[model samples]
Target: MKPLELYLHIPFCIQKCNYCDFLSAPSCAGERKVYVESLCQKIRSYKDLAKAYHVVSIFVGGGTPSLLLSKQIEQIFEAVRETFVIDSDAEISLEANPGTVTEEKLQAYRNCGINRLSIGLQSAKDRELKRLGRIHTYEEFLWTYELARKAGFLNINVDLMSGIPLQTLVDWEETLHEVARLKPEHISAYSLIVEEGTPFYERYGNGKHLEELPDEETERKMYYRTREILESYGYHRYEISNYARLGYECRHNLGYWNRTEYLGIGTGAASLIREERWNEGEIPEKLDRKAQMEETMFLGLRTMKGVSKAEFAKTYQRTMESVYGKVLEEMQKKGLLLVGEDQVCLTDAGIDVSNYVMSEFLL
Candidate 1:
């Protein structure tokens, strides 16, 4: 049977952050109970598909999955196990906001087969956390992290953000240093983008709020500094925005970059199955060879490992050079890419402008 990853989106949050554009909302207890029932129904609906695939990973992502009662989370997992052929050693992860989790909840998650915890603690400074409209204070995050550790969650990830309004390089550095000291198994450091439709966009998408935010040079410095500091703390940069201790990379996300088949359940989730992509209840779009190649390069190159030439040839039945030879040569000459005998990867400079480099692979 083919290996597959599973993602369940829980769209309820205590409050929406200013910069978030994901499908999420503040929900009441009654509404949450109803949503859990629907989510379980959706999970059971996939029984037939489960026969052909063994679930190798499951990620309960959010809004704030931890907002749900522990029993509700257990119900979702129960439905999944009943319907799917779950691998015995599958990596099951739960996304928790700092203030939303408790000792009882963490213990319940462990009992229900969740072995990893990803806590959203965007900054370690109270002022920065407040500026981002985060619901949790830095102290709350520390409490939650300690609770997870005590609850036997050996594998944990901390999420951090850079480039908020009124944030300085010192603030970003402090956040990084503080998180690293906690020694979580994984870390995801992302730059804050003022996405369209987010509250942040209304205030800062244009030059109107630029002075309050870090300048381009400062933001770039923050990005590079993240790599330097994390690496210094024994965290390896496995991807552009992800660092991990050895053997601690997020398998569900790796499934995405490797183009592994996955099923996404719940409202507004997306799935890629059998080379076709679809959103919930939508018609699948079959990917052509060119489209697949573009995905293979751009997604795979996001990691430090980059694209493996042998795997690319095996998948497409054509050499990587046959497709992106000219682009690779140009990028290499410009010191943006490092083309090795077995793999092609982006240089440090290339990663800073990765959007443009990845776009060049589109045909």
Candidate 2:
């Protein structure tokens, strides 16, 4: 059977962070229960499609899935298993935030076959957390982390962010050191981007509070410092912004970078199957060969391992050289790309300006 991935989005949170533009908001218990029930019904609607593939991974993400009662979580997964053929060794992950998890909830998750926990702890500094409109303090995150460990969660990921108003290089370094010492299996260290529609955009997008945020040079330093510190703590940079110990890379995210087909279910989730993309409330977009090729290059190059030349040929029936030869030559001369006999990827310098480098592959 074909390998498939499942993403279930839970659009409920205790509070919306200032920097967050995700599809979630504060929800009442009644609303949450209704949503969960609706979501399970949607899962049941996919029974026919499930016969064509076996699910390899499941990611429950957004607004803070941990906010739900453990029973609600169990109900959702029960519906999934009833309708889908889940692989025995599938990696099941749930996104959580501090101050929203409990020992009972953690144990319930384990009992329901959830094996991985990705906790949101954007900063180790309480001041930064408050400035970002985070609901919990640094101490609350520590409590949540220790509780997850005690609940027998062997695989865990901590989400950290750099670049906030009044954040300094020292602050960023402290956050990394504090979290890495606990030794989570994975760490997604993301640079803060002031996205549109977020409160941060009001403050920084029009250059209103730009002076309060780190300068471009300092932000770059924080990026490098994340790698420098995480590597010392035994984590390797597998993706542009993600670090993990050997064998602990997030399989669900890797699937996205590698073009694995996935089904997304929720208010605004997206799905890709048979080279066609579907988003809720929109017409399905059937990716043509050119669009698919662009996705293959841009997405695959996000990883340190890069894209395999042979696999590209197998998928497209066109040599990687035949398609990107000139672009590769140009990038190689500029020291922005490394072309191996079997693979092609970005160099460290190239990753620093990866947006420009990946844009070169847009054929």
Candidate 3:
């Protein structure tokens, strides 16, 4: 049977963060029931497509999936079981915000078979959290973490931000140290991006920038520092922005990076099945490889594991070295790529400049 991963988006937040552009709206208590029903309708419509696959993972993410009441979470889980042949040991995960998680809520999630939890704890510093417009404080996040543990969540991932306005290299180190004390099963350290149309773009895009936010060089140093510190604590850098304990890597995210078949259900979600990638509609061929090789190369480079040379040759009937000799040689000389026996992956330098490296594959 084909292996499948599922993603469900719940686009409701108590309040939208200033820097976020995800498909989420401020939750009006009166409107939540209607929105939940709409979500259930979407799940029902797509249920038939998932019946044949052996569901390996189920991830519910959003503005804050924790905003949904326990009953709502139960309904979603029931719908998923009814629709898919979920594996007995599937990695079921839910994204929760620190502000909303409570002891009772965590216990309820455990009861519903949510084996993993990804909590958004952007920063441990209150001032930085305020600058990012985060709804929770560091103390609140700690409370949530303790509650999750008490409620029997053995696998938890904490989200941290590195390139926030007014953040420094020292601040990055402190954040890592604090998180290490919590001893989560996984950590995702992401750099901040000032996307267009956000309040941040309008307010601080042009004129004044926060001095605390480090420059490009400093950002690179911060990433390497984070990787080094996390590695010491036994967290493996499986992906560019994610680290996990030996056996606790997030299967849901790994499925995406490996270009495995997945089903995304919700407004604005993306999916890939049967070698066809779709987000609203099919992704342009120009944006990806023809069928298999495109996903293989692009997705492979995103992880520390990189792409396998033999696998590429087997799929394309040409060694990757022969196909892109000049580019590989140039990148290797620049220390951006480290070619290995069977695989080739990005170096720290390459990961720091991944956008440029990823663009090279486009040609």
Model 2 per-residue lDDT tens digits across residues 1-363: 899999999999988899999999998999999999999999999999999999999999988999999999999999999999999999999999999999999999999999999999999999999999999999999999999999999999999999888999999999999999999999999989999999899888977868999999999999999999999999999999999999999999999999999999998999998898997657889999988888899999999999999999999999999999999999999999999999999998999999999898887
Q: Please provide, for model 3 over 1-363, each residue's C-alpha lDDT reduced to its tens digit, 9 standing for 90 to 100.
A: 789999988888987776888888887776777777777777777666766689999999998999989988888888777778889999999999988987778888988899999999989899999998999999999999988988989999999998888788898899999998889999999988877788877766765565645787898889889989999888999999999999998999988888778888776778887766666434623323444665677778999999989988987788887766777778889999988788888998898788788667754
Q: What lDDT would each prediction earn against the true structure?
A: 0.93, 0.94, 0.85
TM-score per candidate: 0.99, 0.99, 0.93
The clash tally of candidate 2 reads 0
Instruction: Give candidate 1's whole-model lDDT.
Output: 0.93
Model 2 TM-score, all chains together: 0.99
Name the lDDT value of residue 188 in candidate 3. Answer: 96
Clashing pairs for model 2 are none
Please name the candidate that would achieve the greatest lDDT relative to the true structure. 2
The superposed Cα distance between candidate 1 and the true structure at residue 49, in angstroms, equals 0.8
**Per-residue accuracy of model 1 over 34-113 as CA lDDT, tens digit each:** 99999999999888888899999999998999999999999998999899998999999999998788889988999989
